[model samples]
Target: MNIFDNDSEVLQIGALTIENGTDSVILSGDVEITKTQAGKAQAQALLDFAQALCAVFDELDSQGLPATADKDPSKVVMVNNPFE
Candidate 1:
């Protein structure tokens, strides 16, 4: 008999385990499609977040450095709560 026969009432999709019970399909795992429109939007949001983080770090580095015509080798400085 085929696995899709009346007696068989379950299906697996990637990491998901779906059970076709008397009145419902029970999903046992989260499902994600990396190529779907929603997935692409999520990826783009993540990329934007990463770029924002990099920009913050760059700003902190610039703020900590001094603008001088000559480099000084004897100045000792400490930065506190750069984000604040």
Candidate 2:
């Protein structure tokens, strides 16, 4: 059988998707925010997700891939705060 054919195995796997070019972030599955531990875990999970994008492009650059030199896409330095 293929991997993850059992329901119990599926529960242990989580997927996170992030798109640096479009400024998008996603967390896999439903999140429970009632507990402080759960909330912090979810937030940290997202932060780690964004960081993973840098390695992808860095690998491409190491391979001599042509990329725009005008901007540093991996560094998420400033965020637009609407409440400010």
Candidate 3:
């Protein structure tokens, strides 16, 4: 399941819990992979999660908005409309 989907707010894969927020994304839980087949699958899922985050970062970069941009809404200053 795509955790980035609009309908998905919380997604749990293996021992990882991902929470999608309005202004942030939260990740909780520990990922411990053993040497068994289940461990391999868990490792793959972790990799996929990392790749997905990378893709989201890339998309944000393409939009001229870096992920590290200041997110303080209170610090935002409204400017006068130039078209007015």
Candidate 4:
């Protein structure tokens, strides 16, 4: 599934998709990740989560899905999050 915006790079997630009103942020590609309670989590939690996510992407890619998700994809940094 993919969502394309003119000039804005397309976001494609294997067979996974995101629609309007999902309360998610497109960090990169077609992966829409939701913010977690990092404040309450351990210091390594975020890193652990990222590793797990990468693993998932790898698995998905092996299953014929693309692994293009990233925290920073050389995208234009938004001055502010519209959702906020």
Best by TM-score: 3
Model 3: lDDT equals: 0.75
Residues 1-84, model 2: lDDT tens digits: 112123222111124322223222233555454457767776776565445545655765698866545467777588799898
Candidate 1 colliding pairs: none
lDDT of 3 by residue, 12-84 (tens): 7677788876456788997788999999988887788788878886876788865474779999899999999
Off by over 4 Å in 3: 1-7, 67-84
lDDT of 4 by residue, 1-84 (tens): 122212333223433333322222244333333455443343344355456556755765677864453555577665877788
Best by lDDT: 3
- Model 4 stretches astray by more than 4 angstroms: 1-41, 66-84
Could you arrange the candidates by TM-score from highest to lowest?
Answer: 3, 1, 2, 4
Candidate 2 Cα deviation (angstroms), residue 76: 33
In the order shown, the candidates' Cα RMSDs to the true structure are 23.8, 13.1, 9.3, 13.7
Please give the CA lDDT of all the candidate structures: 0.54, 0.46, 0.75, 0.42
Flag clash pairs in model 2: none
C-alpha lDDT of residue 65 in model 1: 38
How many clashes in candidate 2? 0
